[model samples]
Target: MNSPRLAPPTTWFRMGLHRYLGWEQAVTLAANRLSGFRPVRAVFATASRLGDGIGWYAILLGLAWHDGLVAFQPVGWMLGTALVGLLLYGAIKKLTARPRPCAVCDGIRLSVHPLDKYSFPSGHTLHAVNFSLQLTAYAPELAWLVVPFALLVAASRMVLGLHYLSDVLAGALLGGLLAMLALLAQ
Candidate 1:
């Protein structure tokens, strides 16, 4: 028998991915393919920064402050999910220790920089999805605006070559689920 396995499914699934995916080849392909697009890079860079922690949080807090109790309650849920997403995705990144695409591929046009090293789950996307989805839960009217930003932020991770497509996808799923969990906890 194979002696043992830890994180068996994760390992096998990653291993089984054809050579062009979730690894160096894909990063190279994506970077080389995306590197020439200055316009896309610029847009994604702005979206990344605007959707990131300080940017989005400022908007939420500003809404809370301006709108009085009406906005405060939903902002509360948004903040709660942000906290839960922070802890949850932080742990997953630590555990996965996946390298940022920048570490391996150079063909991508660099735009906004990342704050951390690992790349299994895009932290920006995590917060983006978490905050926006939770906004829908407690602040429905704002969802139309926030949801589109969330999608752009997710795409930005890949466009910047800060993450693989899978990383963005995983972050989206994690964030959505965790946001729901946070709401249920309340």
Candidate 2:
């Protein structure tokens, strides 16, 4: 017969997989390299911790406390966005089941111990962007600090090799959208 034989589904899948993984690995390795210096490692590690931990909340709480209960409306807005955004992040992570960059990229910084296994969408960056959005809407003056801090948090995820650029950027965009929705609700 003159008909051509098509490759099996598994073979096609493997080829596609390798192409994406190879690209992801190369990008991850390059970003991980930025963490070679001790100061960068220290900054990124701390940024990751602060991003993922209660540090963000501490800042929110402090702001709310300083401004009184009525001024705490911004905190409510941020928390609501965080809740929705994080839920979306969790769903994407579960569906993708992507591994952390550190797991794929050897010679990683091994900064702070990650709380979860998969790293499709970064919760830290999600929170950072959501909070920053609310801050921008409520307090433009703080946006100068908040915006940079959010960007740093997003970058920290890559520097620590915990996430890819796609993960953080997706988180940031989704987070901003969620915050906007929360604002409408408010």
Candidate 3:
């Protein structure tokens, strides 16, 4: 009889190895509970609720609907970067049907209202990374704030046990690549 070939380790296993080291429960709890903080909750809530509609509106208003030298130029760049990154993220999500961590893991409880879809690469992390990268490219001085904020967004997904580390890593890479392409195209 031929031996069976084991499947490669899932992205969850590689990125979520920390869970086996005793911090899984603690980190999940922190990620889930931190949302209770008003400011933190507000930030996440706003991002989550806006979806892609806001991005669309910004792009339209800034690029197609506006006509100004100083103001429209920056808006055009910002909207262009955000739109390209978001479109790429959506495409990847559609292509990879990986299940969300919560769907596969019984070890942790997820947020009550978590997104309903695959979790190979987190959309939230991608958005944050892309936005930060674009901002950094435009105004290098804001690196201190943008970098930390991007890190926080990635950490929040991990803490919430909503994504594997690999998901965030892939998302960061995707965002950076898309942002670079967008900038280059401009």
Best lDDT among the predictions, by candidate number = 2
Query: Which residue pairs clash in candidate 1?
Result: none
lDDT of 3 by residue, 100-174 (tens): 666776665564356658777877787777767776776577678667767766776765557766678888898
**Candidate whose TM-score is highest:** 2
TM-score of each: 0.80, 0.84, 0.63
Model 3: how far is 5 from its true place, Å?
15
Candidate 3 local lDDT, residue 134: 71
Compare candidates 1 and 3 on lDDT and give the better one: 1
Candidate 3: misplaced stretches above 4 Å? 1-71
lDDT of 3 at 180: 80
Order the numbered candidates by lDDT, best leading: 2, 1, 3
Global Cα lDDT for candidate 3: 0.65
Model 1, stretches more than 4 Å misplaced?
1-15, 19-28
TM-score attained by model 1: 0.80
Error of 2 at 19 (Å): 5.2
Q: Sorted on TM-score, highest at the top, how do the candidates line up?
A: 2, 1, 3
